[model samples]
Target: MSERHPRILVIAEAAHPEWVSVPLVGWSLAQALRDVADVHLVTQIRNRDAILRAGLVEGRDFTAIDSEALARPMWKLAETLRMGQGKGWTIVQAVSALSYPYFERLVWQRFGPEIARGDYDIVHRITPLSPTAASFLAGKCARAGVPFVLGPLNGGVPWPQGFDDIRRAEREYLAPLRAAYKLLPGRGATLHNAAAILAGSRHTGSELPASARHKVFWLPENGIDPARFNRVAAPGDGPLRACFVGRLVPYKGPDMLLEAAAPLLRDGRMVLDIVGDGPMMPGLRAQADGPGSGVTFHGWQPHEAVQDILSRAHLFAFPSIREFGGGAVLEAMALGVVPLIVDYAGPGELVDDSVGIKVPLGTREAITTRFAAELARLAKDPGALAPMAQAARDRVTQHYHWTRKAEKIARVYDWVLKGRPEPKPDL
Candidate 1:
């Protein structure tokens, strides 16, 4: 291990500065790492313009691999298979499994010599965060004696029980076939050869084979860029101001959130701000339209508007049942708004009693009841939420900020370079 900063080749095929979801995550992480390591980012050609706009010299700071010949066609196929946009995410990933190899193959073709000669201390693949997306670089780097790090790999959270109707509505037809990813080519070799694996969630961490468990470390893939989400909610003298920001789809439980908060909205005990749009908009709008139902629908606001609404909010009432990363929850928490999320999957894992609230997972009716009860209780005593909101903000600053995540990843780089030390980083 070098005493100087580790030279890392960060591979994030989906990274893009202007996008959200996986692309933003990959872009944020890759940029953050530059402060701690000698990072050379390699990404797909589609992100080249965005990367250039962000001020990086092409072929010097990064290299854009043109894999569109295969990626474009495969992406079109995935779009068709998904049935509709933003639906059938599982189907998209399942189809992408076939085309991702081409990107890595081109990456190796260009960088193999430098990697083989030990020019880079480590090769870290940060995107295609799906645990199912096997890496060709893992075995290649392993054979070259250069340590390779995989993930904050997330996804593969099974649809929880009692959500079959919503699952079908969301067009997640391929979810039952998700386990077949383990049988994909290079899946075994990628896991077996990686020097360290960063599992983004506990569910994802548990999915790795027993042999790979020893090298795995828990690190949530979602992170907050403090500058983007720095607003702190100032609870004024009024009803509890709550907001729900996500697609108005069955799985996100927007309808359930509306049902739960309906009483409060009608009684003037709470004000609800719904900050997104989806297929269920017309139905949800109708559901909220009665006397004194203080529900405001700011349909599909930009990130800035979302943050504006969240900053003035006291509670973030997001009842998403099967969220994998829960990035919106983090965004809300970053704004010092206490989140009330279901006690399952990503939200359950990100929050605890000190920072936010979590209601037990159950059927749609049961969850709605629980959420309603919690919202009523909170509305009755809004002053008690202040402490939790501050704690949530502090938690994000310490752990969930992109800078902090980069620092933690730097520690990971050190650990892997130090020959697999005992007591892995408990980040």
Candidate 2:
């Protein structure tokens, strides 16, 4: 390895050069390290056009692997079946079963030999935190004498501010999986293969095995491209425009937002603009058209359009209870829109007293009550919302920029290559 620069490999299951924040993480890392080292990004490529549009220069510091080519036909059929099984199926079984294996065979196998041949200094594995893929790639890196880092290791349920509510949700969703995950072969492999682990949140960092906790590092949830989400002051005139962007899933709490808006509509307070589409779209649309609901479902818009919508929005309502990192929240914050996030996992880290309101998570009634109170307060006090919006923009500009995130990640790669420990941040 060169004394000045180190070769790095980034492996992820998601298709790169896309709108998704996961792929953007890999892309940003590659861009950051291009000047000092050889960076090869190995990821699934769903849309070649998107990859090209991303300005990825092949054979020069970056290369992409298409995971679809390595996918088994039976796997696709199984995934189709699983997706058809609805939300519960997608959450419980399909996510780990169908998606994990695809990464193992296609992503791992396709990129492993190339990584080995390159004599990489470090290997960074991105999210979903598949023990299978982590094990396979970690093994490959280990055999090649390269240090392996697995992370952002997301997928944990949100942590409610109330200890009882958080404990209850953990018992229902995470407790059962712990026993099963311990028995998986990949779990053992992951422990043995990885030299270090990175977590996006304190909650996820705590979830790491006792053996891996020593090497665990915590980074902010998401990085934002400031150009995309430019700051805009809310107009103090007509009805306020509130927007919710993301998949229309139950976990995302779209229904809860709809419910919160229902009371507001009865009093003629504001209008709700719902962007993105999924299985819950029909139900969301039904609620919008139904009496006492003031929601407008815009269906799925292009990535570029999301920025435009956020620019016009007065507030960003994110009620998700199971996010590891709130990427959309960061985008909104960068755009100078105040975020109303739940006091759970991802958004919890992003929203503070200065930036936005964080409602405590609880039973349906508790959540609804908090949302109603906060929404009403924001709607009534126009002056209060302005400072929070400015704080959000200032916070993003100072700490959450993509360039800063990439620099930190590159430092980790350097430390691993030199067989040195990560330095504790001077808080």
CA lDDT of each prediction against the hidden true structure: 0.91, 0.68
Cα RMSDs, all models = 1.5, 4.4
**Residues 308-337, model 2: lDDT tens digits:** 777777899888776767889988988888
* lDDT by residue for model 1 (147-252), tens: 9999989999999898998889889988988898889888999999999899999999988999998889889999999878878888687999999999888888
Runs with alpha carbons beyond 4 Å of true place in candidate 2: 1-3, 32-36, 45-49, 64-75, 83-118, 127-133, 158-179, 231-233, 289-294, 419-421, 425-427
Angstrom error of the Cα, residue 253, model 1: value is 0.7
Among these predictions, the greatest TM-score belongs to 1
The TM-scores, one per candidate, come to 0.98, 0.83
Query: 150, model 1: CA deviation in Å?
Result: 0.3
| Candidate 1 Cα deviation (angstroms), residue 398 | 0.9
